[model samples]
Structure formats: structure tokens, C-alpha cells
Target chain A: MNHKTASNLALAAAFAGLLSGTTARLNAQPVSGHEAGVSGAAIAAGVAMTAQDDQKLPKHSCKGKNDCKGQGGGKNAGKNSCKGKGDCATDGSKPKN
Target chain B: MTLLELQRRMEQDVRRPLTAELTMQPRTTEGESMDEIAAAYIRPNSELTSFERLEIYNRQYWFRVIGAVSEDYPALQALLGDERFDALVLAYLKQRPSTSWTLRDLSAHLPQFLEQHAEFASEQHRLAVDIARLEWAYVEAFDGAEIEPLASDELAKLGPESTLALQPHLRLLAVDYPVDEFVLAVKKPEEKAVTSGAAQLRQANVTTTLPAMAPEQRYLAVHRYDDVVYYRTLEESEFRLLKALQERKTIAEAVEIIAGEEQVATIQQTFALSSELGWFCHPTI
Candidate 1:
């Protein structure tokens, strides 16, 4: 699953050579043993995660219909999920199909 | 109590009805709500319908949290079926309160949650946990933090005599099932396995059928690559060495521990693969 390309191979070797950079890492908190700053990562990652989830929404059914002719729902259903068409109730529970 | 105390209680009560699961516990700030609570905000304006304003936060809040969590653990939901997944997620919301401000933070503990919960066992809930863990790590790697990582200078600083510390953000996981494989199977562009159920048959292997290694220990290391969280597995020796390092073992001691094992070309290959995948930060510098 992880065979590297020619470019990635070079990157790997370069990373290997960069071991000198991490010396400060060893110095930062050798005694405590836990890496700090996880909360920052959590929040940053969370924003991206949530944004990605939002983009993946499933399409709603009531996009079409000229007159709101079908079963439109009541006030509680809101404009987003409810069409408020004929035979439509307040809750928007029934599927038009 | 004082007016402030009473004000907080009323706010909690008002917020309670906004939740999709109204039965879910309220976030009573600072302490318990007083017998007589004060209103934090004026009652919904009679001019503008109360339901309109309230629905904005109520539905959006519920959908936002649920949607965010759904992405992190899609495979788990796929395994559980829509109805069961929704029910469990609702229960999950109540039992485990959100401590982290973001929904992704809420996912960090979901795997552990499903494993311990009795309601989920029939699905071989362990499998669900594995899927969730992998999904969570993938999300973490997709957009997490990054450090330049350790450099050769840092590795040299150890001097072969000193103990080395492992980064905290790096996580090591040992799982049983081939969850990554399963996840891959679902993500294939041609067919959407997540929607279509029926567990795909896997190649029969010693690990799958044999009782000795029934619960195969799949070693995984999770760390950030540049700006994202990425992970790869290590071999027996590599895992032990990292474990030793995480435990603050000296280089000489950790190497000594590994030297006891059979050193073959494959082991070195394993280390190379792991190191390439950001398993180990640059040595020390």
C-alpha cells in the first residue's frame, strides 16, 4: 500500500538527513515525556474536519416544484428541509415519493 | 442565591428545549440552577415568532455537531445501519459531554466509547472501534499540527548515553482487524462500499483463521507530516525501540533490546518504511 515514488524517495532521504533539526525537540521536555500543544492541534483539526463534513451533505428532495404544489410542511419544518406545499404538514415527516 | 446565580439557572432551562434530544442534559454553568432562575435573555419577541429564532440555533446546533462527528466515523455508522447509528450517536452525545470546543475533538474518544458500551456488542463492536480509530487518525493527519520534526543534531545530542523523548502528538495503535484495508475497500471510486453493506470477503490468512494470533496486533504510529497528521506502522523491533524511547530509554539500551531480535533485511526495510512515513521525527537536532 505504500510504495514510494521517485520524488517521495528523495523526500524520505532528505528527512533522514534533517535529524539535526529535532535536537531542540529532545531538549524541550525530556523529563515530562508528553508532547505539549495538543489542544491547538485539536481545534485546528476540528475546524477542517467540520468544514469537510459540511461540504458532503446529501441533497434534499424538495428542490423542484413551481407552485409548492406537493406536501409542504408547517412552521416547525423551516425553509431548509420543508417545502410548505399542498398536503404538507407542519413537521414535514412524509416523503413525497 | 444572588441574581447572577438565578440568571444562570434560567439560561440553562431555556437552552434545554433547543436541543434535538430535549431529554439531553443541560449545560448548567458554574453550578446548580437555583430554585428561582432569572432569565438571561428576554422571552422570544412576540412580534417575531419564537419558533423562528429558536429553530435557527436549535436545528443548526444539532446538525452541525452530528454532521461533524459523522465524517470522522462514517464506517462505524455504515456498520451499524442508519437507525442504530443515529440512536447510538444521540446516546453518545449525552453520556460523553463535549470538552473540546470542536466536534473532531469529540471523535477522539468515540472508539473507546463504542467498545465499552454494551448496546453495541452485537455488531462485533470491536470492529466498529477499529474503523473509528483509523478514521479519526486519518482526519487528524488530514489537518493537524506540524513541527519540523527532529533533526540529526537532535539525534546526535543523545550521545548514545542519554535518554530520548518521543513526541506526545505521535500516537501508536495496535489493532486486530485490517481496518485500513476495509476503509480502502469502501473508498474505492468505482463502488461505494460504505452505502452498500455485506462484509466483503477477505483473503484467508494465518492471522485471520488461526487462534494463536486471532487478535492480530497491528502496530500503528500517528504523527504529523508537515502540517497534517499521518501514520504508518513499525515492525516488532521498531515498535519496541520507539516504545523504549517513549518510555525515555537511552539509545544504547533501546538498541541493545532490539539487537536481541533477529536482524534481517526485512527489519531494516520496515524501519525505512516507517521512518519515511513520519514514524520517527528527525533524530534529535
Candidate 2:
């Protein structure tokens, strides 16, 4: 075998020789298969927002509170969700002075 | 509030603001509930004295760490764009809110989180998950443990059916994008070429109108070797091999399985490659 091939073989032998049961137990945790938990798009957007800020460039908003009020706020409304005790809480009660 | 209620409320107060999806934290301009909570928990450590400035510090703390995570997973940022990524991170903050005092704990479930994303079938998504996994592993490898190197004779003493154990800080991941390429981009930003066959194939659609990838995901292996964090690509066979080993299969069994479909030469090659990575487990008392 050539150098790369020899090295590859050595690595394989080493793998073959390495211990396993305890390792298996340690790695037994399963990856959850849920959609909301992992989204590449969500992760990417975070980076873009930061990079844009680092450049101090003009930007649009979506799902955020800062300058993104118009461009970004689709369903998100800054620090508080639109559900209870927040922006949505303005409906029922009346207070007269 | 009852003690239980007070505890619950305090915990909620600490956690809710930390996970809020907004760019800036909610504050008390004059007299707001959040501001009151902030006044209670936060003590300003910066030069700014105004309560407003103090609140700003509280908000900045979370954003800073999140931004660091964004730095750690730029490919993810690229895939989600600026707005959505922040939103997703905010969502992540809400559900699996941080409990640690350090920012590094922020990435603990990133790979698993990405695994659960509905739209994360894209190569970028896969790359993001994988790089996140590697980055976290690297952190753990550096901070979590100190151990002896593999001794060649260690496995010889084991019975044919005995199971070996992997190191505590090591992690193996399967991802969608060529995460190595994504991390490489982060490391050099400008100099490196994207070389993985998977990455090239996924990118091929950019020049044309065609959409790339039926599923656009990739697989990965992340681990620690002699205190250095290392990431490597895994073929289907290789991943299964690792999986089997992870499932407590003996080395001979794992080799037999890997060698079943693959050529003896390739299996031998793979075994050698995995060995150097210290993919073997070491059992202890």
C-alpha cells in the first residue's frame, strides 16, 4: 500500500482493535426527530442578522424588535410573544379615568 | 405568592426574558413589570448608570452569546438569512432556555434541534447542525476532560464479546451539509475552497435554474483526539460502522459487518482511518 493507503489501514486496524460496549452505552442517546427543534434556515438567519449589524448596514425586519419593526415582524413581536399578557392583551378590559 | 409560586415566578422571570424573541429586551421606561423584575435580578456592572443602561446590559448579555452562536454557525445563518435565524434562535431560547452561567452551554442541543426542524432538509441545514455539533464537541474536549491516550494492548485483554467505551467528551454526529466546508469557511472566511464532493454537488444548482438535492442533507463524525477537536465526513457504510460500534458491537463484529458489503480493501482502509481518530472505546472501573 502507498503511504495514504498504509495510514488508512493503520487507522482501520486501530479502530478494529479499539473497545466498544462502553462507548456504545455512552453514545446511546437518540437524536430527536422533530421539525421545530432543528431548522437550518433559523440558524442561518441569526448569523445574517449579526453580520449585517456588524457592518452597521441598513436592513429590514422580521420576527425581531430592534430596527426590524417593519421589515421583519411577521408573527414575532420583539421580546414578548403575541399570546397572553402582551401585545395581544389589549382586547377585553376597559379603564375609565 | 406561595413559596412554590415564588420559586416558579422567579424562575419564570429569569428564564422568560432570556428567551424573548426580540432583538432588544423589554425594559421599564417609567414603570413596567419587566423593568421591576430587571431591577430585582440585574445589577449593572458597566459604566452606564441609568436604569435604562443597566437594562441594556441585561439584554446585551443574551444577544452577545447568541451572536457568538451565530458566529459559530454561519452556514446556518446563510441558510436562514438574518431575520429568520434570529427568530429561530429566539424560539430555541424560549423552549430550551439557558440555565447555565456560561454562553457555551447555548449550543448543547443544536444538532438535536436541527434534527427536529421541518424545513431543515437542505444542505445548509445539515451543515449547520453538523458544525454546531463539532463546535460543541471541541469545547467539551478542551474543557471537560483529561485522559490517557489509547494503549495498543488495551483491547487484547477484552473477551471476544466484551464492549468497549468511548471517552466522555467525544461526540459523533450525522449531518446534512458538508459541515466541514462550512466550518472551514468560518476559519479562513476567504482563503479556502469548498472541496467536499457533497458540497460541490449541492452547489451545482446555483448556476442553473434547477434546484439542488433531493434532500440536501449530509452526515458527519465529530470527536476529540489527544485533546484536539476533529471533524470528519462519514459514508453510509462508515456511519453504520460507527453506529454498530456505538451499539456495543465488538471490533471483530463491526469489522465483519463493514466488510460484508464493502471490499476487503475498503473495509481495511476505513478501519485504519477510524482507528487514528481514536474511535475505539476504553472501558474502565
Q: Please give me the DockQ of candidate 1 compared with the native complex.
A: 0.05
Once fitted onto the true fold, the runs of candidate 1 whose alpha carbons sit more than 4 angstroms away are: A1-97, B1-56, B166-169, B187-216, B223-233, B264-285
True contacts kept of each: 0.03, 0.07
Residue-by-residue lDDT tens digits, candidate 2, B171-191: 556655455555544443432
Q: What are the DockQ scores of the candidates, in order? A: 0.05, 0.05
- Tens digit per residue, CA lDDT, model 1, B1-285: 678975664444533423444322333355543222222332345433334333333444444455556656766676677677767776776677555745557667777778788586464677777777877776655555444544555544544456645545666566777665555444321222233246665532211111111245677666653344444555666677667767777655555555522433333443334333334443343
List model 2 lDDT by residue over A15-85, tens digit each. Answer: 45343322332233235784434232122111221222223322211213332212212123344333332
What is the total number of backbone clashes in candidate 2? 47
What C-alpha lDDT do the candidate models reach, one value each?
0.48, 0.48
For model 2, the superposed segments whose C-alpha errors exceed 4 Å read A1-97, B1-54, B119-146, B192-219
CAPRI-style class, candidate 1? incorrect
